[model samples]
Target: MSIAAVRIIGIDPGSRHTGYGVIESERGRARMIAAGRISTASGTVPQRLLQIQRELAALLHEFTPAEAAIEEVFVNRNVQTALVLGQARGVALCALAQSGLDVAEYAPTQVKLALTGSGRAEKLQVQHMVKVLLNLQGAMAVDASDALAIALTHAQVRGMKARTDALAGGKRWGRA
Candidate 1:
């Protein structure tokens, strides 16, 4: 059976810079569509949140992705910094929901593991894997590469689930 391509957008939310990447995935292959960061460096907390929302909304409209994925906010040493990051993540979630797309969240370790063999992979290792998996060249921002890694994680996960379901004779297995 031929598997249809799925367009997915992945987001790595931050207070000052929110990274986003779009990709088209079919079977085990994935192709990059677009990737960039939304900067909100010169604004207050609320203003930065609003900027993230508006820019994310525009990107959603432009990409028209079938699904979305976001990296979960990791615990930070500074509570205040974690709170701000959470706010940015909330804005990103709202934008994805408003676009009427199913949003999936993956932990940072999970994303790294999906891209690299080890969950403890370094940032540079993950970035290198992202470029290798997508056959991409040229300079890419670290944030942008991280976003693409998140997208690729979703693609890999969904593809595995599909195959598992197929093997199970189209029956729902494990957790609902």
Candidate 2:
């Protein structure tokens, strides 16, 4: 028997801590591959940026995801916080581009709505839902589960669209 191979990586970018999860999509099934965080504590600004870049590059190399999805930067009341997040996001994008992985992004509201069916859902609810969907063995931290939820959202939506198209007898991309 032959195997189908497809992989996706999802990232939640932050200056102090970036969260990521890897999932493989094969024969229309999405499976969790790995997850981790990249963080910098008490360092010079440039040094921290360099560290983030290095960590992201390492993650890309290891996962070798065919596609990458990142949570878009949101506007914060604190300008400095927003800038820091944007900086991290920039590095994440650069890493994916350098790795030649296709990148897509979803806003915070979009991710929340997609995962929990409501933008105002509590963090715990999203985390709990993600745990159930992936059949994770143990409870996951908020940031990590959030990253996984984002990936699961993409998988769920993509699968739904594919099924809908099939029922409607329309062709979609990626079908051989």
Candidate 3:
């Protein structure tokens, strides 16, 4: 028996550039549909947020993904940068919600670990793994690759959950 493919959209939110990737996954196999970045470099904060929203909305409508995933904000020493990132994330969440997508949030470490088996893996390592996993040749934007990683992580997690649920006769221990 063959499992149905689940289409997913992943977002890597940033103030200047928000990356998005779309994929269809069935069982443990994933095929890339599209990947790109929404650039808002020459706009004010509000304008940038608006741009992100509009572009994401368009992408969602175009792909009609059944699920969505986004990278959670990782705060570092720079407070202002984190705040801006949060804003971008908020916009992304809103867009996903409006599109009626079930959004899943994953941390940077989770994404890296899912793709490279090491939470502390470097960006290049993650990118290389993304290319390998999707069987793609040639270069891609770093942000777009990160978004693909996020989608792949969600796909892996969902696959595990589905197997566990099947093994347990579709019983849940607690709230999911």
Clashes of each: 0, 0, 0
Q: Arrange candidates by TM-score, highest first: which order?
A: 1, 3, 2
lDDT of 1: 0.94
Which tens-of-lDDT digit does each residue in 1-176 have in candidate 2? Answer: 22345677888888777888888765555678987778787698677888888988988887788878889988979999899889988988998899997788888788779878899888888888777766777866676777877777666666676676676667675564
The residue-by-residue lDDT of candidate 1 on 1-176, one tens digit each, is 45789999999999998999999999899999999999998978999899999999999999999999999999979999999999999999999999899999999999998999888999999999999999999899888999999999999999988888888878767855
User: Which regions of candidate 2 are displaced past 4 Å?
Assistant: 1-5, 26-29, 164-176
Q: What is the lDDT of residue 27 in candidate 2?
A: 54
lDDT value, candidate 2, whole model? 0.79
Q: Evaluated with TM-score, which candidate comes out highest?
A: 1
Could you tell me every candidate's TM-score relative to the true structure? 0.97, 0.86, 0.97
On the 0 to 100 scale, the lDDT of residue 105 in model 1 is 99
The CA lDDT at 145 in model 3 is: 95
Of the two candidates 1 and 2, the one with more favorable lDDT, higher being better, is 1
Model 2 Cα displacement at 31 (Å)?
2.7
Worst 10 residues of 2 by lDDT: 1-10
- The C-alpha stretches of model 3 lying farther than 4 A from their native spots are 173-176
In model 2, the Cα lDDT at residue 2 comes to 26
